[model samples]
Target: MKNIRNFCIIAHIDHGKSTLADRLLDYTGSVTDREKQDQLLDSMDLERERGITIKSHAIQMDFEYKGEKFILNLIDTPGHVDFSYEVSRSIAACEGALLIVDAAQSIQAQTISNLYLALENDLEIIPVLNKVDLPSANPEEVTDDIVELLGCAPEDVIHASGKTGFGVDNILAAVIERIPAPVGNVDEPLQALVFDSVYNPFRGVETYFRVINGEIKKGQKIKFVATDKSYFADEVGTLKLNQVIKQSVKAGDVGYLITGIKDAREVKVGDTITDSANPTINPIDGFEDVKPMVFAGIYPVDTDEFEELRSSMEKLQLNDASLVFAPESSAALGFGFRCGFLGMLHMEIIQERLEREFNMTVITTVPNVSYYAFTRKDPDTPVIVNNPTDLPDPSSIDRVEEPYIKATIITKSDFVGNVMSLCIEKRGQITNQTYLTPERVELSFDMPLAEIVFDFYDRLKTVSKGYASFDYTPIGMRTSKLVRVDILLNAQPVDALSALIHADNAVHIGKKMCEKLKELIPRQQFDIPIQAAIGAKIISRETTKALRKDVTAKCYGGDISRKRKLLEKQKKGKKRMRQVGNVEVPQEAFMAVLKLND
Candidate 1:
């Protein structure tokens, strides 16, 4: 335990956390030159292509410093705010973190976020200034920012170029010298924290954990404290960049525990693992499971693929336990799943993986955050409303509350005016704003998560000319005037098309949706009425005209009365058709309403 170092790299997105991991691997000779790949720890293809770590990954590396052999368990965490829960869990398992800052960009929102999380966990932070080899590199200035922000010594800060492998040796030496070793009793009962898990085709569910005390072996009986399920350890191994099966994993070590459990739900993340015969006294603190914040309905393009879609979602859930789903049926779109996500990016990555990885065509409804509706009958019990269709009548509700977030944006001072305007437009209330540096400012706002979840980030980037970075954490709910706007097709309400909207922009938003639907929906044999309404009151309406045909041309050579009779009969038939015809809204129309711009 004295020779082991358990630490993770923390940084903002595109700040070279992964690049540093690659360099460390190269310097330690963990993987030969022929076997090493760029961003070697990032397992997902989506991660490499997008240049961001979506999932937190851990690998055991062997490093030698001054003829002393040491074991380094390096956990690479995702920098996105959406995966902050996962980040926190990873930090909890480690004793120290390498806080990476861009030499040119200095400190950003996520960098501060990671710093706070590390502080909360009471982990030692090693500030490393990365990308010092770039033309715009300003290590001295960034080092100063770190010193002022974190109050660390000037000499304590390390200057390194993760891109060029400069100061790589110094960074490793600091880990061995400054970072404390794990302090766990080797003779105590087995106690491990399951931080992450993965589902395998042949091995079933594989649980990755950090051994806090005692030891675990292949034949030992282990129990999951949360699930209360006991099983014989089928396999035990340590992660050596890849899995290396071993008979036993000792205290203060990170390894996988395979119990032949096929269901990932049974062996959930954040659950504790202990010896079944002599279990640990208590589970580790801060083991709360992650809850979904935003929701959207996911439907298959073809009705026959509903079962296939369900199966694929189940398999995906085995890997992503945060993704919540249940059977949902839409009148216009058929059977689907109403899925919940940690945030918008998590929702998008899941959608992309489903379509690309599983080879499935699926349509997703507009994303919406959860709301709390206090009903007149049950005013004390606020009903959690995830779907717009679940909301009661406006007269029967006391008040509605939507989720709000404390959003922080760090950008150049030149774009503060533009950013303030955009935030105000999104119903953002400026809580605080201060200049972090002479040229860069930190803008804080208490705003609804719904607003930031939508195109707010893209707009901020555009207004700031890509100079701004954003981060947000939910700050509970706020009371507001919100209403459910229902889109009606041919006078029938579509459950899936309903949206909970703020009352101020309800009318304009409804009218815009009606217009976009009118353009996307195909013309039928009869006129299709597209209307947006709140309860029984219609706010906006648009009509798709019926296909015109020259039915009277066949009677062109006949008598006038014959043509008149034919026209009269056609008019009556049209009236009857309008009464009984059902509007067939194409799949594209629903998607158009989601992406429609006002």
Candidate 2:
């Protein structure tokens, strides 16, 4: 146990976390030369293509220091704010963390947020400055920033270049000397914290856990405390580049356990694993349930495949425990699930994964944040409104409280005005501002969660020329003047197009929605009137003109009575078609609502 070191890498996006992890792996001789690759721990193809880490991956490394062998368990975590929950879970399973910051970018919003998470867990922090070899790297300036932020000596900061493997040895030596090993007694009852799990089609679900007490042996009868389900361990192994079979994994170590449990729900992340004969008294603490920031409906393109989509989501949820969902049905989209995501990026990734991995074509409705609605009859109890169509009638609604978030944005001082303007336009109130350096500034704002759901991030990047880094945390619910806007087609309400928006912007947004729909919805035999309404009042309207047939052209040079008769006959046919014709909304129209700002 004294020679075991368990730690994770945490940083802001594109701060060389994965690259530094690769350096550590190579320095420890964990991978062969043939297996060497960039962002090696990022196993997902989507992660590699986008040059980002989406999943938190764990692997073990063996290092020899001064002729003494040491075991190192390194968990690589995603840097994006959307995956902050993943970082939190990873932090819970480790005793220490490597706080990597880009020398060029200094400290950004996500870096500060992730640092706070590590500090809250009481993990040992090791500051490292990465990418020092780049021409733009200012190691001295970043080192000072680290000293002020972490309150550590200037010399304690390790300057490293992941590209050239400069300070990799120093990092390894610091881990062994600074970070404490797992403290547990082997004689105690087995207690392992399940940090993560993945679904295997052939082997059932594979659970990765950190053993805090006692030891687990191959083929031991184990039980998950949360689910109270027992199963024989089919396999026990350590997570390496490949799984290394072990006869026993003792206390103060991280490993994998397979119980051949085919059902994904049987193995829950953050649950406790203990010996069935002598179970632990309590489950692990400090691990909280994930809070999703965005809510959106995900329905199958084909209605009949509802069951298949459900199964796919279950399997996907096993891999991504942060994803929360429940069965929901839409009037226009039919049977589907209302999924809660961490952010827009997380939502988009899930949608793409469903298509690529499960071959499930799905339609995602306009994403919105959960709101609390209080009705006149039930003023004390608030109704949770995740879908706009679920909102009660306007007359009955006493008050509506929307979720607000504390946004932290770090950017260059030159773009401060632009960033401030964008936030204010989104109904954001400036809370604080500080100049980290003469040229770098950090701005804080209190903004409604719904305001930033659409295009805030993209617009912020554009305004700041991609120099800004944004991170947010839900503050709480605040009462707001919000109205539900419903889009109607030919006097019929389309529930899927309804949205809950602030009353001040409702009219303008309604007009935009009506105009956008006009361009996307194709013309029919009869006029299709598109209306945006709030309660019983119509706020905006647009019409797609009918595709008229020239009945008079066919009766050229004929008598005026003959032409009139033909026109009347055409009008009657059109009226009949209008009564029976159903508007087939193209798939593009559902997606168009999301890009209304474009």
Candidate 3:
């Protein structure tokens, strides 16, 4: 335990944290001679395809320094600001963090935010400037920035190119020399904090954590602090310290425990596992129960796969603690589940995983923000509405408030003015600004969470030419003029196409939404009018350009069977759609405009 070192790799998105993680595994001989992979920590297909780390991953490796064995617990956290909650949880499981900065780009908005989180937790931070092989690499400037921002000594910075394995040994050496050893009592009663967990088909639930202050072995009885439930430890599998071998783990060492637990709901993140005989104190703080902010209804294109979707979600919920769901009944969409997520990215990742991993195609409804309303005679009433049809009557409410966030954007100084104007146009108020470097600036604003949920970040990058970065934290909620916009296929309203938009932008946004829907829904058998309506008023309308050929001219006598088959197929397909007068609206037609700008 005296030689144990636990730390997380912190960096901005695309700053090469996963690349560096792969390099460290190689440096420590954790990678076998027969197997070599790129970005090994990004195990999910969606993560590799999207080029972003969505979840926190941990692995154990052993490093030899001066002929002495040192155990290194490498924890890789998501770099995006939306997943900061996951980052916080990962950071809590470690004793220190390696602050990885891009030498060519210097510090970013996420760099400051993650560094501040580490500082607040009093975790030891070792600054390292990566991508030193780039022609534009400026290690000296990046080192200075680190010193000025983190108050660390400039001489402590390590220059490395994770892609080429240059200066990586220096990173390992610094890890042993600079990072403090884990400190805790090993001989006391068993106590372990479950920082993370994964479900295995064979082994059941595997709960991983640091043994803070006691010795735990197979066959010992333990208890969880939060649930107060006790269970017998089936086995204490040999723990991995990166590539090193460990027969037994003591206090302050990282390890995993396998038990009779099969349900993920039983073992939770941030829960303390302690010996039944004698337990230690629960050092859980700075951790809050994760509540989902954005919600959407996920159903299948084929109703036959409904059971498959349910099972897949159950399996996914094992690894993702932020996902929440409850049975949903829709008059138009039929039975489905109301799924909750941390943010839009989190929601998308789950949907993609369902298709890629589980092989089930799904149709998702428009995402909506949870709202709270108060009347002149009543107090605030909490309501969760994803469909516009569920919106409360405007006259029955005295005030309505939407969640707001305090955001910080870092970008090149050349586009600062444009970013500021974009923020203002999105209902944002400037609070502060800072010159990060001669060519870089940080702008802070208070904006509605709904305003930035969809494509705000993408637009920010588009306007700034991919040089802009952002970070946001919830501030609270404020009253706003919110209106519900419904879409009618011909005249009857389609509940799935409803949205809550600010009153001021309704008309212009309604027009853009209708235009987008016209492009998404394929040209129907008959021309379909896509209209955006508020009550009896139609503000915008567009049509799917008329169908070229509805019926084949060669289906008459001998091909009567084939023609009957084709007509039967079309009838079954039309059963999945909603009809309003003469128009047949495809399911995608209703789901298309939800992500119009996305």
- Candidate maximizing lDDT: 2
Off by over 4 Å in 3: 238-248, 277-286, 303-308, 379-387, 522-527, 543-591, 594-598
Candidate 1 per-residue lDDT over residues 140-245, each given as its tens digit: 8889899998999999988898778999999999999988899898899999988888878788888899999999999999999989999999999999877999
For model 2, the superposed segments whose C-alpha errors exceed 4 Å read: none
Q: Model 2: per-residue lDDT, tens digit, 387-485? A: 998898888999999999999999999999999999999999999999999999999999999999888898999999999999998899999999999
lDDT over C-alpha atoms for residue 229 of model 2: 84
How well does candidate 1 match the true structure in TM-score terms? Answer: 0.94
TM per candidate comes to: 0.94, 0.98, 0.89
State each model's CA lDDT, in order: 0.87, 0.93, 0.80
In model 1, what lDDT does residue 199 have?
73
Candidate with top TM-score is 2
Q: For each candidate, how many residue pairs have backbone atoms clashing (under 3 Å)?
A: 0, 0, 6
* Worst lDDT 10-window in candidate 2: 585-594
Error of 2 at 87 (Å): 0.3
lDDT, candidate 3, at 128: 86
Residue 148 CA error for candidate 1 (Å)?
1.0
